[model samples]
Target: MSDKVVKRPFVNNNCIGCGACIQVAPNYFDYNKEYLSEAKKCETYNEQDVNNAISVCPVDAISWI
Candidate 1:
């Protein structure tokens, strides 16, 4: 077997769509017309993307766990 790791994230109710996370990391974070933050699926990004989200989350809603 392999030891590959995968991560998936999504926008929760707390998402205010401030676009801060997207500005820090565009490869993963994005905003809708309403300006809400969105995270890619678990297998869509690496650790870097997740960290960016966590760091940019003003509400502390983004977490690895």
Candidate 2:
């Protein structure tokens, strides 16, 4: 029952695992086994936080699909 969005966010290969995304949106972003930032949840509940994470990405990796 996930009210998924048409364009969910994702962390691309360009991610440097800076953990900024996690810091910005802990409920959505997390570190993988590779120590990289990955999207734990793609839901668009608090878009402002997500946008903040996207903007803070040093490598501009996070995006919508």
Tell me, by lDDT, which candidate is best: 2
Query: TM-score of the candidate numbered 2?
Result: 0.82
TM-score each candidate: 0.69, 0.82
TM-score of predicted model 1? Answer: 0.69
Candidate 2 global CA lDDT score: 0.83
RMSD (Å) of each candidate, 1 decimal: 2.5, 2.6
By TM-score, the best candidate is 2
Clashing pairs in model 2, backbone N/Cα/C closer than 3 A: none
Scored by CA lDDT, what does every candidate get?
A: 0.70, 0.83
lDDT of 2 by residue, 1-65 (tens): 56555566789999888899999889888999999998875435467778899999999999866
Which sections of candidate 1 miss by over 4 Å?
Answer: 1-4, 41-43
User: Please, what are the lDDT tens digits per residue for candidate 1 over residues 19-62?
Assistant: 77888777777776677877654444677767877887898766
Show where candidate 2 strays beyond 4 Å.
Answer: 1-4, 42-44
